[model samples]
Target: MSAKRPVRRATPLRKPVAGTPAWVMPVAVVAGIAVLIAAFWVIHWYTTPLPPKPLSQDTTTVVVSMMTGLPASEFDAVGQGTANNLIKPVSGTKLLGSTGKPEVFYLGAEYCPFCAAERWPLIIALSRFGTFTGLQTTTSSSTDVYPNTMTFTFRKAQYTSQYIDFRAVETTDRDQNPLQTPSTSEQKLVSQYNIAGSIPFVDFANQYVFTGATYSPDTITGMSWQAVAGTLQQPDSTQAKAIIGSANLITAAVCKITGDQPATVCASATIQNLEKTLK
Candidate 1:
């Protein structure tokens, strides 16, 4: 018989002591990695400010202002008075007006010759529908012709009484710097409405559009803002008449959109009436 080797007892392997220090290292590392991933996700969400979430209501305060145009405080009284006087009551059948979408106007710097001229009429027309809350009376933009261009704080701007909505968007601050990039929707609207990126381009619901006019006749001549402001004070003066005539043209267009309810002159006469006058 072959000699049998002594049998050795099998040692039972102890399960890794529950929660031992060695195991703790791997668990801590996994926990740390998970925390880092969560932090990265949170950082990404906040860093990129998302587009303005759509409000449930169709109405927007800033949107409507864009249609009428920017408000020029200096021309507040006469400009608005003229627009109010000219507005005609809309016919019952044609009462619907304004897309109710946000309106936006892109203007840059106080040095803009076009804005200098356009501001007067725009201010007047917009005031008819809403109260100008924070219009700056001094010129603020460096590139704008109105070095002391009157400023208006639109945050307080509102039109609680009027049926029409309005919006004004200054792409750049008074310093001629970008504020917010134009929205894709805004870009498309501007592209369709802006006449060659003309300063002071105006559009009312894609229905009425005016490039410039409503201030000094010398606007095309590139006169200073002070000079134009002087002309508007005397409505009957030659300078005022030239400016008013242009304003009347704008009135006609605005009236057409407001259903003539707000522009009497435009409603009373045929296109022939003002077309001849403008020339």
Candidate 2:
């Protein structure tokens, strides 16, 4: 019986091939997955269209020309269409200015639908104080609430004025990629006043702040840039009421910062009345 038990033997354990490393299969599988992912992204890149280039000189002129606000009566007619009192007083902060002038800080993103809607009034208001060059056109993220909302991009834009100084930081583009970076102070002001850290945020000389769109993006949905600019000229239009009305209030805010410097704008009956409502 002892001899029979001795004849039994255990099965041999399987070993990797003599020349191959044990880890090679797993490494190859991981590498294959990585290559597939890279290839997918590469394909996507080639398939997607790029954002449009900076606006042409003629188009810019037309758009800027259209930004000139509507009549005081027209503004009253479309008052606050989908827009509430967006601007608020940012207390406990020093006057935000630079180079001996008041500063208007803008923080938003290209893919933001609310920012898209807000830019209309914002640009309308700013045009009264300064000029913009190198403005580009883009649409909000197609997957967002207001998909393909055609609007302007401030990324390559430059604002110039004698009454006030302007600063804009487009944190991300339509693809949600990192864009312009804001200075520490610019970011701090946003953090302090805009606790929610919402975009389309604007700071007017530390006197007032806006955390959201002045109007709803739905108003301008499905509209083209040229079509929207066309609406600004029509005082009776819904777009005019929302955009021009909001622009009037913004103008009033800017007026307070500039001491009503540019009488042509601040002294307007519209802005004067709106200025009184400021906090």
- Of the candidates shown, which would achieve the greatest TM-score relative to the real structure? 2
Residue runs of model 2 more than 4 Å from their true location after superposition: 1-57, 69-82
Clashing pairs in 2: none
Q: Model 1 segments beyond 4 Å from truth?
A: 1-111, 140-156, 212-233, 263-272, 275-279
TM-score of 2: 0.76
What does candidate 1's lDDT look like per residue over 1-279, in tens digits? Answer: 999999999999988756566788899999999999999988866763222222222233343243234333322223322322222122122212245532324333333545655655555445554455545432344333333333232322444324355655555554555654555765666676564776555555565455544453243243333444555556555545455445555555555555555442334444235433332
Clashes of 1: 48
Estimated TM-score for each candidate: 0.49, 0.76
| Superposed Cα RMSD, model 2 | 6.5
lDDT (0 to 1) per candidate? 0.46, 0.80
